[model samples]
Target: MKKPGRFLAPIVIAGITVGFLASAYKFVFSKSESSKQTTSQPQDSSNTSSSSKNSN
Candidate 1:
Protein backbone atom coordinates (compact mmCIF):
# COMPACT_ATOMS: atom_id res chain seq x y z
CA MET A 1 0.00 0.00 0.00
CA LYS A 2 1.05 3.57 -0.51
CA LYS A 3 0.76 4.37 3.20
CA PRO A 4 2.97 1.44 4.14
CA GLY A 5 5.61 2.47 1.61
CA ARG A 6 5.70 5.98 2.99
CA PHE A 7 6.22 4.77 6.51
CA LEU A 8 8.76 2.18 5.41
CA ALA A 9 10.93 4.74 3.67
CA PRO A 10 11.53 6.76 6.82
CA ILE A 11 12.19 3.65 8.87
CA VAL A 12 14.74 2.42 6.38
CA ILE A 13 16.45 5.78 6.27
CA ALA A 14 16.59 5.99 10.06
CA GLY A 15 18.00 2.47 10.38
CA ILE A 16 20.77 3.24 7.90
CA THR A 17 21.60 6.48 9.64
CA VAL A 18 21.81 4.79 13.05
CA GLY A 19 24.01 2.01 11.71
CA PHE A 20 26.43 4.46 10.10
CA LEU A 21 26.63 6.58 13.26
CA ALA A 22 27.24 3.57 15.51
CA SER A 23 30.05 2.31 13.29
CA ALA A 24 31.70 5.71 13.15
CA TYR A 25 31.41 6.15 16.91
CA LYS A 26 32.95 2.74 17.53
CA PHE A 27 35.83 3.38 15.14
CA VAL A 28 36.71 6.72 16.68
CA PHE A 29 36.27 5.47 20.23
CA SER A 30 38.53 2.46 19.71
CA LYS A 31 41.32 4.49 18.10
CA SER A 32 41.34 7.09 20.87
CA GLU A 33 41.24 4.50 23.65
CA SER A 34 44.05 2.49 22.10
CA SER A 35 46.19 5.57 21.65
CA LYS A 36 45.56 6.71 25.19
CA GLN A 37 46.61 3.35 26.60
CA THR A 38 49.78 3.25 24.51
CA THR A 39 50.76 6.81 25.38
CA SER A 40 49.97 6.49 29.06
CA GLN A 41 51.91 3.27 29.47
CA PRO A 42 55.20 4.80 28.32
CA GLN A 43 54.74 7.85 30.48
CA ASP A 44 54.01 5.69 33.52
CA SER A 45 57.10 3.57 32.94
CA SER A 46 59.28 6.63 32.59
CA ASN A 47 57.91 8.12 35.77
CA THR A 48 58.54 4.95 37.69
CA SER A 49 62.11 4.70 36.44
CA SER A 50 62.83 8.33 37.29
CA SER A 51 61.42 7.91 40.75
CA SER A 52 63.52 4.81 41.34
CA LYS A 53 66.64 6.67 40.26
CA ASN A 54 65.86 9.54 42.63
CA SER A 55 65.34 7.11 45.52
CA ASN A 56 68.69 5.46 44.85
Candidate 2:
Protein backbone atom coordinates (compact mmCIF):
# COMPACT_ATOMS: atom_id res chain seq x y z
CA MET A 1 0.00 0.00 0.00
CA LYS A 2 1.02 3.62 -0.38
CA LYS A 3 1.23 4.00 3.40
CA PRO A 4 3.61 1.07 3.75
CA GLY A 5 5.87 2.40 1.02
CA ARG A 6 6.11 5.75 2.75
CA PHE A 7 7.10 4.10 6.01
CA LEU A 8 9.59 1.83 4.25
CA ALA A 9 11.32 4.74 2.55
CA PRO A 10 12.64 6.25 5.77
CA ILE A 11 13.70 2.91 7.16
CA VAL A 12 15.66 2.06 4.04
CA ILE A 13 17.25 5.45 3.98
CA ALA A 14 18.25 5.16 7.63
CA GLY A 15 19.78 1.75 7.11
CA ILE A 16 21.84 2.98 4.18
CA THR A 17 22.95 6.03 6.11
CA VAL A 18 24.04 3.93 9.09
CA GLY A 19 26.02 1.63 6.83
CA PHE A 20 27.87 4.54 5.25
CA LEU A 21 28.58 6.15 8.64
CA ALA A 22 29.94 2.91 10.03
CA SER A 23 32.31 2.53 7.08
CA ALA A 24 33.45 6.11 7.47
CA TYR A 25 34.23 5.53 11.13
CA LYS A 26 36.23 2.42 10.29
CA PHE A 27 38.29 4.21 7.64
CA VAL A 28 39.07 7.22 9.82
CA PHE A 29 40.04 5.08 12.78
CA SER A 30 42.35 2.90 10.69
CA LYS A 31 44.15 5.89 9.22
CA SER A 32 44.50 7.44 12.66
CA GLU A 33 45.93 4.24 14.08
CA SER A 34 48.51 3.99 11.31
CA SER A 35 49.62 7.55 11.87
CA LYS A 36 49.75 6.98 15.62
CA GLN A 37 52.10 4.03 15.20
CA THR A 38 54.40 6.04 13.01
CA THR A 39 54.47 8.95 15.44
CA SER A 40 55.04 6.71 18.43
CA GLN A 41 58.26 5.34 17.02
CA PRO A 42 61.45 6.55 18.76
CA GLN A 43 63.22 7.47 15.52
CA ASP A 44 62.08 8.98 12.25
CA SER A 45 61.28 7.14 9.00
CA SER A 46 64.85 7.70 7.81
CA ASN A 47 66.19 5.24 10.38
CA THR A 48 63.71 2.51 9.45
CA SER A 49 64.99 -0.97 8.57
CA SER A 50 63.57 -4.18 7.19
CA SER A 51 61.46 -6.23 9.59
CA SER A 52 60.24 -9.78 9.65
CA LYS A 53 56.63 -10.94 9.58
CA ASN A 54 55.39 -12.41 12.86
CA SER A 55 52.84 -15.16 13.34
CA ASN A 56 51.38 -13.66 16.51
Candidate 3:
Protein backbone atom coordinates (compact mmCIF):
# COMPACT_ATOMS: atom_id res chain seq x y z
CA MET A 1 0.00 0.00 0.00
CA LYS A 2 1.15 3.55 -0.69
CA LYS A 3 2.11 5.75 2.23
CA PRO A 4 -0.58 8.27 3.19
CA GLY A 5 1.98 11.09 2.99
CA ARG A 6 1.74 11.16 -0.78
CA PHE A 7 -1.96 12.02 -0.76
CA LEU A 8 -1.93 14.09 2.40
CA ALA A 9 0.87 16.41 1.31
CA PRO A 10 -0.93 17.60 -1.78
CA ILE A 11 -4.15 18.15 0.14
CA VAL A 12 -2.39 20.13 2.80
CA ILE A 13 -0.61 22.23 0.21
CA ALA A 14 -3.83 22.93 -1.61
CA GLY A 15 -5.60 23.91 1.59
CA ILE A 16 -2.82 26.30 2.48
CA THR A 17 -2.89 27.81 -0.99
CA VAL A 18 -6.64 28.35 -0.85
CA GLY A 19 -6.46 29.89 2.60
CA PHE A 20 -3.75 32.27 1.54
CA LEU A 21 -5.72 33.36 -1.51
CA ALA A 22 -8.90 33.87 0.47
CA SER A 23 -7.14 35.94 3.10
CA ALA A 24 -5.47 38.06 0.46
CA TYR A 25 -8.78 38.71 -1.25
CA LYS A 26 -10.41 39.66 2.02
CA PHE A 27 -7.54 41.96 2.95
CA VAL A 28 -7.72 43.81 -0.35
CA PHE A 29 -11.50 44.17 -0.52
CA SER A 30 -11.80 45.11 3.14
CA LYS A 31 -9.35 47.94 2.72
CA SER A 32 -11.23 49.28 -0.28
CA GLU A 33 -14.56 48.94 1.47
CA SER A 34 -13.29 50.72 4.57
CA SER A 35 -11.89 53.55 2.52
CA LYS A 36 -15.17 53.96 0.68
CA GLN A 37 -17.05 54.07 3.97
CA THR A 38 -14.65 56.58 5.45
CA THR A 39 -14.99 58.90 2.47
CA SER A 40 -18.77 58.68 2.39
CA GLN A 41 -19.31 59.05 6.14
CA PRO A 42 -18.09 62.62 6.32
CA GLN A 43 -20.34 63.72 3.50
CA ASP A 44 -23.30 61.94 5.06
CA SER A 45 -22.75 63.57 8.44
CA SER A 46 -22.40 66.98 6.89
CA ASN A 47 -25.60 66.58 4.89
CA THR A 48 -27.50 65.49 7.94
CA SER A 49 -26.27 68.44 9.97
CA SER A 50 -27.01 70.90 7.20
CA SER A 51 -30.52 69.60 6.77
CA SER A 52 -31.14 69.82 10.50
CA LYS A 53 -29.84 73.36 10.58
CA ASN A 54 -32.16 74.35 7.75
CA SER A 55 -35.13 72.90 9.62
CA ASN A 56 -34.38 75.00 12.71
Candidate 4:
Protein backbone atom coordinates (compact mmCIF):
# COMPACT_ATOMS: atom_id res chain seq x y z
CA MET A 1 0.00 0.00 0.00
CA LYS A 2 2.81 2.41 0.79
CA LYS A 3 4.58 1.53 -2.44
CA PRO A 4 1.39 2.03 -4.37
CA GLY A 5 0.89 5.46 -2.86
CA ARG A 6 4.42 6.50 -3.78
CA PHE A 7 3.89 5.50 -7.40
CA LEU A 8 0.55 7.24 -7.50
CA ALA A 9 2.03 10.41 -6.12
CA PRO A 10 4.45 10.84 -9.02
CA ILE A 11 1.73 10.06 -11.54
CA VAL A 12 -0.60 12.59 -10.01
CA ILE A 13 2.08 15.22 -9.96
CA ALA A 14 2.95 14.56 -13.59
CA GLY A 15 -0.69 14.85 -14.60
CA ILE A 16 -1.05 18.18 -12.83
CA THR A 17 2.13 19.51 -14.42
CA VAL A 18 1.00 18.44 -17.88
CA GLY A 19 -2.38 20.04 -17.40
CA PHE A 20 -0.78 23.32 -16.30
CA LEU A 21 1.58 23.35 -19.29
CA ALA A 22 -1.24 22.63 -21.72
CA SER A 23 -3.37 25.44 -20.37
CA ALA A 24 -0.48 27.87 -20.56
CA TYR A 25 0.24 26.81 -24.15
CA LYS A 26 -3.41 27.29 -25.10
CA PHE A 27 -3.51 30.72 -23.53
CA VAL A 28 -0.38 31.81 -25.41
CA PHE A 29 -1.70 30.35 -28.68
CA SER A 30 -5.01 32.16 -28.36
CA LYS A 31 -3.25 35.43 -27.55
CA SER A 32 -1.01 35.08 -30.62
CA GLU A 33 -4.06 34.30 -32.80
CA SER A 34 -5.84 37.37 -31.54
CA SER A 35 -2.77 39.49 -32.16
CA LYS A 36 -2.56 38.21 -35.74
CA GLN A 37 -6.18 39.10 -36.35
CA THR A 38 -5.75 42.56 -34.92
CA THR A 39 -2.61 43.24 -36.94
CA SER A 40 -4.00 41.89 -40.21
CA GLN A 41 -7.10 44.04 -40.14
CA PRO A 42 -6.67 47.74 -39.50
CA GLN A 43 -9.01 50.68 -39.64
CA ASP A 44 -9.25 52.16 -43.13
CA SER A 45 -7.84 55.60 -42.27
CA SER A 46 -4.98 54.21 -40.19
CA ASN A 47 -4.26 51.74 -42.96
CA THR A 48 -3.89 54.48 -45.58
CA SER A 49 -1.68 56.58 -43.34
CA SER A 50 0.58 53.66 -42.59
CA SER A 51 0.90 52.83 -46.26
CA SER A 52 1.62 56.41 -47.18
CA LYS A 53 4.24 56.68 -44.46
CA ASN A 54 5.96 53.57 -45.73
CA SER A 55 5.94 54.91 -49.30
CA ASN A 56 7.97 57.95 -48.17
Best by lDDT: 3
TM-score list, all predictions: 0.57, 0.60, 0.60, 0.62
User: All models: lDDT?
Assistant: 0.95, 0.78, 0.97, 0.89
Off by over 4 Å in 1: 1-4, 41-56
Q: How does model 2 fare in lDDT?
A: 0.78
Q: After superposition, how far is residue 33 of candidate 3 from its true place, in Å?
A: 0.5
* Best candidate, TM-score: 4
RMSD of 1: 3.6
Clashing pairs in 1: none
lDDT of 1: 0.95
Candidate 2 Cα outliers beyond 4 Å, as residue runs: 1-4, 40-56
Regions of candidate 3 where Cα sits further than 4 Å from its true position: 1-4, 42-56
Worst 10 residues of 1 by lDDT: 1-10
Worst 10 residues of 3 by lDDT: 1-10
Candidate 1 or 3, higher TM-score?
Answer: 3
For candidate 1, lDDT tens digit of each residue in 18-55? 99999999999999999999999999999999999999
Note the clash tally of each candidate.
Answer: 0, 0, 0, 0
Local error of candidate 1 at residue 55 (angstroms)? 17
Put down candidate 3 lDDT per residue, 1-56, tens digits, no spaces. 77778879999999999999999999999999999999999999999999999999
lDDT of 4 by residue, 16-43 (tens): 9999999999999999999988887777
